[model samples]
Target: MSDVLQSAFNAFLEELKNSESLIRLTVSTLLLILVVAVSRFLLRRFIRRNIQSSEMRRRWLIQLRNILLIVLVLGLVVIWGHELRTFALSMVAIAVALVIATKELILCVSGALIKGGARSFNIGDRIQVKEFRGDVIDQNLLTTTILEVGPGRSMQQRSGRMVVLPNSLFASEAVINESYSQDFVLHTFSVPFLRQHEWRPAKQKLLELAQKHSEPYLEQAKRHFARLSYRTGLEQPVVEPRVTIQLQCAEELHLIVRLPTKEHDRNQTEQAILAELFADDDYLGDYLPRV
Candidate 1:
């Protein structure tokens, strides 16, 4: 009985030693590939079904899913055939080669991850980073896409043209999020008048119009500002609608109306204000130059 047991154990060891390791590795690799493919397909479907917001879904599908899938595949590969030492050395060599060969890409991707993780901006948010100002349309591992907006030709308006910018630029540049924390941002409009006109009535009327137009946003902004101030141990400024008149070009009176406005509605609000101003000549007649 002892000889039979020894013989069986030795046969088992010999079989393991003489087994075609390459064949095993190939089979394992094929299985890993198949698992990854199926997982990706199922994950995509699950994400689509579970994520309600289109923007959030796009981000998860494009960025998060790919990262998880890669990690899983790598883990399976290491477990299937490679020894820990061999895997560690291979990974270190790959990392070194990646650092040397794709330094810029690595920096950009890493910067993007940091920025995204910090919640610096989100899709549809208006952001100004460096010379590029636009609505964020897409964010990826290395780049953040913008639907450019502004005056110059370089400023691609919301005309669907996308500008892809490397995320590393944020490290060196100041980033301004127009719709940060709050949906509405302050929009100021300037109306020029002759210096001789009494500005009080016009200013009052402008303030009233601004309040009327932005009543909802003003209320919300005031509450948000108050909370923020309290949290930061600062005194909150009195939240009221107001207009300031400034002397410009030595002769013209610049009546500036500052009000809360949605980013997309800024142009519309400006046009509406101008239309209202023109429609009521009596209100604006005091500011007109004397013939």
Candidate 2:
């Protein structure tokens, strides 16, 4: 068995020695790939060690990985430049026919390129394109899939459907990113009061309740807004949870409550606020009047 194995190894080495250029190129390509991969891994480790706590570190890591991959691709082209060009030229007619035959595939690939360049949305982002609305669960060069949420009354709840959308959709549709700046969104609901009732107390109490429930998300928004403003050159909007008294009609005084909430938690936060409203004596007896 040892003699047979030695013979086989010697024959393989002899074959490789006979094709010196091919062996060299093959080994060099593997080495280049390994070097690129190791550098990427080391860069990731360094970032994790030093900048793991940084807010924008994840974006930076992704960018660095892309740059390394691009460099590896260019390196391969330089190493096998002549052979690749000749092979590509020979296959040009066939490639053209394939592209035309796979029209949808080409469109999807182009759309993916456009989507990446446009920075339309990212994974875990809740987006609405056309009538499809959901959280992005997966994306590929050919398709972008979402976990479908909401159908009728259950607006925020998942509908147990995974929507597989072709990346091509972004070329012709508007994408509404619900929580682009932060993981939270401004959610508002109103409570009713009689016009004869003193409104200030209700407003004050609601604001307090909203602030209490919304404090964490507000803090997160503040951090995200710092980055968002720096990138977009847009002024930060007032994120302090507040209550506004709006007269919906002559017959009704609407105590409008607004707060920052996680996109998934908006309904629950609204329900909790509503439940707490009547729990307070001021909100319940606002219309009881002067006795």
**Largest lDDT belongs to which candidate?**
2
lDDT by candidate, in order shown: 0.73, 0.79
Error of 1 at 200 (Å): 5.5
TM per prediction:
0.55, 0.52
Instruction: Score candidate 1 by TM-score against the native.
Output: 0.55
Question: In model 2, what is the error at residue 221, expressed in angstroms?
Answer: 3.4
Error of 1 at 42 (Å): 62
Where does candidate 1 stray beyond 4 Å? 1-100, 152-160, 193-201, 231-237, 262-264, 282-291
Clashing pairs in 2: none
